[model samples]
Target: MRQMRMSHDEPLLAIDGLKTHFFTREGTVRAVDGVSLTVPRGKTVCVVGESGCGKSVTARSVLGLVDEPGRIIDGRIAWQPGAGEPVDLTTLDPKGERMRRIRGGEISMVFQEPMASLSPMYTIGDQLIETIRLHLPLGKEEARDRAVEQLRRVGIPRPEERLDAYSFQLSGGMCQRVMIAIALAADPALLIADEPTTALDVTTQARIIDLLRDLQAETGMSVLFITHDLGVVAEIADEVVVMYLGTVVERGGVDEIFHDPKHPYTNALLGSIPRMGAGAGRRLATIRGNVPHPSDRPAGCPFHPRCDAAIGGVCDVSDPPHIVFGEARSVRCVLHDDGAAVGGDFRVDGERA
Candidate 1:
């Protein structure tokens, strides 16, 4: 991330009361139910959750990609432009051409599945040039040159040759690199990378993460990374948001979140990560039970059904409220409600004090 003028003014991107839902035969699935977060300029915020917990949907809604039967029903996503003025992204007309500029130019994103996201019909060079041209006012030659630079910047070996290759012609990791290159060419102030390394091998995953960290460090662009992997969150995120079902269960700085996880869901997630040298012989700790189906979600705390501490009481009768812990930590769990059971200092996984 390049050096930017940091001010005490405001965040690069701020989301408030974000609610995206889908009307399906099952019911109204709340993919992202009232999520609110901020990414300070040049920092990284990660949204970690189980599958279907609305991580991707939240990012998608930010980019206005929610399809039919599904839409961003509420909330505001505002960007702090050059000055201190707040630009409302939600109310802007999609076809105004401004949204297009912002998609790749101001706030870019790299989707999870490159195979599905990238077009096989178009060569990598063609796609990159097209995307660059969309965001920049440069001529074809300039845009192509910038695209090639972006490809090289993203660590694609032999960019000139890779540009001529089709999506299927490259490996999964290469496709993702191309995706990152396209996103980089936009010069976005904020980048939303949705599970950007899920499709790669372990070594490739580490490389991609390192590349992202390096790029973000060089550009100072804020990033919103979505993933279900707590390990990835621990490795890259400066801050963390733990989501269960469609709601944010806990949030805090990386140190506090990893060392003092409070929500049951958050603790369960941490417990499930395989420690080094544990070897494949040992059974990896699992979260037990899949995420509830959207239509058949548990009533009260959506995670109550999976929470071992819950002895079938009000956890099944009422939803827990989000409470502030300290300056930067907060949790949404009945165990921390009022001055209840174990006090707010109690551990969720018996690991934190």
Candidate 2:
């Protein structure tokens, strides 16, 4: 994590062995399984994985957004919450008044699709004001003022006038910015953004990232940004968590995970990233197999079949112990076995039977 540039203070929020599962007709599907992570004050952690990797489920669980069939059957989400002990958010029911208060008041989330997250019937200004008033005991006029200020802070041009416009009236990028403003309206301690830039163009995405970074620095808010883009993870994440089939296979600072990736899954994900300019003309690398569906997860290590360096019998029969490379790095893979081409802490092979 040295390259990721962290301050090393205690985290504002910490997730410990969290699991989110859904009860379907067949069986329970584990979406987030025994995952642990921490977001320090003013630091960002990017949870990167392809679709259906449980990244969204993990984020939703934090905000109590999982509903109906999905449930937080295991683990704890502890938040610093100003000056309190790490409060376990999983114990709070979403509909309960206290949990409701905590959702938008202490913690906020912006969905991947701004259009879907925003009410089509409400004007942008009305929605922003509603969010502010929902958490704060401010009067209508004060809340409206805060809304306009937040809109302006997010770089929404002529925010006062545009506040009256509906969702359809604004472009995708503008709508995304409005979502950002809505999240900021409450001055929350943590922000969970799930693929927030999916609707915007590349340049607009960069601008949004810049705006978010600036706002986080100014407010000292911890952000859990959920995205599949390694490039985005590289640029914005102070720490990284890589997931596969509802499990965290690797966790470290952005530099350690990306530059010195130890897990085969992490290596495969990094290999798939396209290199341009100096690496031009080189064909893009690809990971052949698709992510396993929750209903039919492979036995043993979920990633063994796809891992090129897997030790035949070991990965086929058992899950590897999580190996710690340093204070800032850890990986879950049998490749950590001693004398491996890429080494960490692998056991010596016993003599042949």
On lDDT, the candidate that comes out on top is 1
Which 10-residue span in candidate 1 carries the lowest summed lDDT? 1-10
Query: In candidate 1, which residue ranges exceed 4 Å CA deviation?
Result: 1-8, 277-281, 341-345, 350-353
TM-score of each: 0.92, 0.91
The Cα error of candidate 1 at residue 19, in Å, is: 0.9
Clash count for each candidate, listed in order shown? 8, 2
lDDT for 51 (candidate 2): 90
Superposed Cα RMSD, model 1: 3.9
What tens-digit string does per-residue lDDT give for candidate 2 at 1-353?
00112233557777888988899999988888888887878889999888988999998888888987999988878777665355678887678887888887888888899888888998998999988888889999998888889999999989889889999998889999999899888889889999999878999999989999999989988899999988889899999989888888889999888777777778888878877673657778877788888878877788877776666767777877788887757787767655334333432221122
Which model scores highest in TM-score? Answer: 1
lDDT of 1: 0.84
Every model's Cα RMSD, please?
Answer: 3.9, 5.5
Model 2 lDDT on a 0 to 1 scale: 0.83
